[model samples]
Target: MNEALWALGRGTGVVALLLLTVSVVLGIVTRSGRPLLGLPRFSVTLVHRNSSLLASVFLVIHIVSLFFDSYAQLRVVDFFVPFLGAAKPFWLGLGTLALDLMLAIIVTSLLRRWIGRRVFRVVHWFTYALWPVALAHSIGNGSDGTSVWFLALALASVVLVAVAVAWRVSANFIEFGNARKGETR
Candidate 1:
């Protein structure tokens, strides 16, 4: 039924957001070459990769369910194009833009070996843009966006990402300082 499809779309979207939050945190941890929660560095990397893939799966389901739900009235063009939706075009467009970034990131990641690390890394940076855009889309367009639970979830995700980014920045600064000390010595 339409209600079932709507529920499926919303549920999958929430799950995808959570998974993406995990993936982003793990990715930062992996880049620092440090183990997370006592896991080995390699394990962190593996979890990061797996979580990203899982989030992509959930994202696909979310999109598909919404596309089928009559309430959404989504056309095929709405998937590829941004800001063209009949309802809440700006918010929906953010989701479309995030999807576009995700596609680019996924393709580049899959071809990393062939494209080389530099190119892959450049494309991967789009992920930084993707997460917030996706989050914005969720809050701006979602039916439960104003609910307490959804706001809590969004806040938690933001805090987690902010902390991870802070840690990465501080780690980099320390490493740079140590390198300078070594050079001076």
Candidate 2:
């Protein structure tokens, strides 16, 4: 029935949001400089990377299900090209841009060996770009954007990314401090 399909679509969206939240948390907790308080390095890194990949998988499912569900009115074009959605073209265009960025990051990651570390590292910088793009997509076009769960997830992602960035900055500061101390010695 139509109702059943709508419920399924909503459920899929919810799952995708949850997965994205987990991915962001894992990423923040496993950063080289700010790993989770007591967890072993290898374990945290494993979980973080795998969780991110899982989130990406869920994202693919979420996008695909949009086409199947009659309620969302998602077009294939809206997934690839920006500003083409029948509803709120600008917001949906953000989703399309996010998808493209994700695709580029995924492809480069999978081909890292062939691409070589220097080139791969350059492309990897785009991963940061993907997060903000994805955040905008979820906030701007997500159907459940106002729901408590959605808001929590969005805020968590923002906080996690913020913390990771802060950790990195603090690390640089510490290195600089140590270098100065060494020079004084």
* Candidate 1: residue 20 lDDT (0-100): 96
Q: Model 2, which residues run further than 4 Å from truth?
A: 28-34, 172-185
Kindly list the per-residue Cα lDDT of model 2 for residues 68-163, writing each as its tens digit. Answer: 777778888888898898888887788788778778777887999898888876776676777677677777777677779778877876887787
lDDT of each: 0.92, 0.71
- lDDT minimum window of 10 residues, candidate 2: 171-180
Q: Could you give candidate 1's per-residue lDDT for residues 57-114 as a string of tens digits?
A: 9999999999999999999988889999999999999999999999999999999989
What C-alpha lDDT, on a 0 to 100 scale, does residue 3 get in candidate 2? 66
Cα lDDT over the full model 2: 0.71
Best by TM-score: 1
TM-score of 2: 0.81
